[model samples]
Target: MAVVPVRLLLLIVGVVAQYVGITPPNVHPPNEQLREQRGLERSLDLVLVTLRILLWSWAFIEGSILFALSGYCPPAFARPFLHLPTNLTSDPTELTPAFLTGIVLTLAGALLRVSCYRALGKHFTFQLSIRPTHALVTDGVYGIIRHPSYTGFMMHTVGYLFCVLDRQGPIVSVCTGLLDGSGTGHTTVTRVWACVWATGLYLIYALMFGRMNKEDEMLQKNIGEEWRAWVKRVPYRLLPGVY
Candidate 1:
């Protein structure tokens, strides 16, 4: 318990480090030019979209700190009617299994994203907008899938959620013996918060999926039958067997 705050601080630092480590400072344009380009509506500017995702990410982290550290929640907010567990602390052993797993997954995901960066070189942009001189990248890991970069980002998000859920919710307490747990993930209030949080995450995921489709459409249009042939060979978008 005494070290919990320190651990929490480290967790935040780790999150920032993940961003700093993976994203190349030079890759994204100084000013994205995504207005009404590549099938995207003018309203859906790349800057706006990036800002939206950043806001969501910040909210998720803040929510985790509140719900996990002190069980704080919104004013005038009501708990859910259904029952769930909420009083779980991160395990205190040298390395709790769930915590260890979370760290490993996060690190691995970071590596994957960095690999994607190296593979794409300057071709990678923060937005769906493609450069006129961009070549249809197919060799290397790109041949394995349509979007390794997205897969990397998805993996990082999943790992983050897993760590937060296991350490901060009662559903995972039994595995680590951190609390009484009540055999549930969260109490009504926490569940409600979680649902709201999950909904926000789902929206981001849907947005990313949309970006993937839009990018694919753009590629097929630009690259022609060669792109379609590569798609037939690769087949999967984010996952191997499942979507």
Candidate 2:
């Protein structure tokens, strides 16, 4: 039977997970608390938010085009892009290690994020701000990692990258064009894109580190000993075994 490319399917699932985890009820900080954020913190928040929007928009558009091209008969609108690679469906039993890993991580991250939402309730916000009734949450996924949501976010980002990198699709094609203007599949372009993506991943980790520290400081000040004790009990921030 035919199916949408696994990577494309993964992309759709991941995006939906993000939307579900973040959209409803807003659950954001009040205007006063939001304004209290440090300049650098606010800048970082905006940058990350903007980056996600651009990246997800790009991924969805690219994935859609690739999906259309993957059909046994390419859509008339997609025919102009016929020069692109078109391996859409694959045997489930023969899935690549990277693809399987992406699927696992994406789902795991989504679940983790949802758990965090439940644990934090109204306290959760995309911004780093403490609400009037903000209380340090220690149960649920938080018991494992202080910043389970960040871990989830990292996992989702990395998983999506893995899914895209596992095969030649729009990312490869576009990066190739950007690298050498040939739009032809060039090995050098592939390697360059990998390096670029790795750099972006590092930036994400760095961003998370900053945000985590800021959050810890905010909570430590607001909640005092209780927050410190919870951190001591949990120990880890993003990863369980490592830091």
Candidate 3:
């Protein structure tokens, strides 16, 4: 069997980290409740999930781009579209600093996020909705930061972007190709696709931060003194030292 290239391996790992979700799917908040109170959040999450899936799909295209650049070229049909500038100049098998950094971030984020999910147990949900008999968790990762999961997710997202949108990646290639001839293909298609990616990222950041505040307020309202005490003890929402 042919050994998979390090770049390919990193891409695969990043994709896995990107798609991993909370265990016991029932942990999701009640849609009716979320829609009733934080309708914007509920709507944003729908956009978030769709864009995320599209981002995941890009990994396959990135792999195809890499394979075309390597000695092992893809089939004749794909060769036309795989003409990314990096393909000719860069070695897909070589691991770049950006790629390595991205993989590390993705894995670290995934691990932290997963730990948070486990720590929260049945309390964790994709949306902000306090379940019946909901209790605040102040142990494990939650003790260090009130929103460690968000931090993990942000790290994972930024890292994955670094990895997949590097010079060798397809999106960058197209963006670069727009200015430089030897880059990727298409003009209108590339710009639109790039914009969609950008919008998705923006939504993720904006919505997550908003949701964090909403969560804090909700917790304070519901849990009262215990929530306030936990905040004082933790002192930070997402980061340990930084806000």
Candidate 4:
């Protein structure tokens, strides 16, 4: 199997898991309450959710097609979208060591993300809506990081990028190219387009951090000193040593 085909299969599974994991109708907040709390009607909420689902789902499907076409067909067709110099157009990419490792990371991330939700059980909602009856979750994965679930999401995004684009990771995301004798600059990401891809993916991790921060504030407000104590003990937000 080609990396792209494996990518296609994995993406299909991911999209399906995301769909099935969507908060059920029974878990949704009441229409009036939802409007009062979220400043959006139930219908509007549904629309927003539908749009999110469409965007995420379509992105993978579209990426798979583009990767496949680029790998197998004439370079000219996919050249405009591809980096100036790319291995995508060369010999078929099989299950290389890095690609296989990426597969493991992708699956691990998905599992970790899902496990967080399962641990939360009835307390978990797709949106930020919290029940008055809800309790602060600090056991299991939460014990590791304040937001291990988001960490898992980051893993999925990173793994996907690794599996398909095979761009440099976080370090490379911030790294810029230095011009070499070759027309192409010497850098982990050889093209501005590659940098854009890196930026977009990293932005999602930032978004997750923002969400986690807001969640911490909400938890602190609701749970008070106990929440403070948990925060002190856990310390880390996403990464253990970093932030």
Candidate 5:
């Protein structure tokens, strides 16, 4: 029987521990008080809150399953540094300044996401179809970014890249890094796959935005010229000066 090296054994154990929620030293829960304070306290309000949580949970579970099945992990050295538990045995070179930057970006994105969730208040729902209670929230963070959720999402993606900057980032990262650096003839088929996934994400966002825009139009018709004036004031839709 072929024997697994101690280092590989340890790395596998660490990965398993992470998946089981063993509470890595670098992982910390977001502000609990702030999370609780933002939403409505009523029982009915739980519906929207539950839906929101479930949607994110689904995404995480799906991604994890897909990655595991594909047997792909990215190289952390070429990109970001991840502040993972020191107890985990792996490549020391994974820790770098770039990884730290990724961590900071990720945290900032998480905070923005939480802020957007708070801003949504009772209107937050998981279904692709807009709920009746949904309203065009143009105040708070929404005032600055038309789709604060998307901003939060972008930040979250950056954070994810940072967190996984080790041997577990993404399969595509590993494939590309190997091909680019080692001059190996290995082809990265996942590049196109990643692009497709990205396009899907963008399409989902676009659909959500379209729904919101339609809702906003209805709101404008109902509320009159007030919304139009606000739209004029907030010129940018997603990114500033771009689109």
Candidate 6:
């Protein structure tokens, strides 16, 4: 069968998995509570969150642009080998077991990501600043992993890449594989560039987390030593025992 159907199938599987509790539940602080708080609800915090949202939105837009541009890109050297035989009837019967498996994985990944975002809600600001509304949430999904959302994000990215590869056939695999093989060459260089970009993103995230921790400390100073004890118990910021 066509790649689109395969992707859809995977997406459906993801949705099912999410409903079945395979994914973490939303655990971010409530928006109303954060808004009502005096320290975290500053005007500057709002602006920062807005800017972060815009930046992430731009990432989505850029992905769309790349997908559109792919139409014009020339086929890779291994295109012939990777190409699916078109002579087969374009019927549902053509849906291979592998394609179905891909569909399930993709769908599960997408659903997990969506659930994560929904759970994060207003707390999902992309800025490197902690607003007054910030709170140290450690219940729900947070109890299991400090940042289950990031885990979900990684899974979603993998699913996305799989979908793209499936749709584009083996040409993508050949090109990417070759690029991977040529050590420190152009492709490898590009991959490193991506890693640098990702590192920068993580650094920004770290800064934001640090800011939040500082805010938490400030609150503890006002609230008393009890808060500090709680922080000590948590240990990790993003990961559990590992971090």
TM-score of each predicted structure versus truth: 0.64, 0.77, 0.80, 0.61, 0.47, 0.39
Task: Give a tens-digit lDDT track for model 3, residues 153-199.
Answer: 88887787677556544445555555655544445444665576578
Comparing 1 with 2 on lDDT, the higher-scoring candidate is 2
RMSD of each: 8.2, 4.3, 4.1, 7.4, 13.1, 10.3
Candidate 1 lDDT score at position 124: 74
lDDT (Cα, tens digit) per residue for candidate 4, span 1-243: 345556555555655544433334237554433313332322335643653565475555455444644457466656554443332322323444554566666677878778887888766654565676778888898887888877776676566555545433211221222223342332444465457657765555454555676688778887999999999989998888898
Q: lDDT: which is higher, 1 or 4?
A: 1
Worst 10 residues of 1 by lDDT: 76-85
Candidate order (lDDT): 3, 2, 1, 4, 5, 6
Candidate 6, 77-108: lDDT as tens digits: 32543343333212212333444554556555
Best by lDDT: 3
Q: What are the per-residue Cα lDDT tens digits for candidate 2 across 57-106?
A: 75676666556655643578666665643332322213457756766777
Each model's lDDT comes to 0.58, 0.67, 0.70, 0.57, 0.45, 0.44
Clashes of 2: 0
* CA error at residue 144 for candidate 5, angstroms: 1.8
The 10-residue segment with the lowest total lDDT in model 4: 169-178
Ranking 5 against 6 by TM-score, winner: 5
Model 1: residues >4 Å from true position, as ranges? 1-13, 21-94, 167-186
Q: Provide the global lDDT of candidate 4 against the true structure.
A: 0.57
- Most accurate candidate by TM-score: 3
Our model 3 lands, by Cα RMSD against the true structure, at 4.1
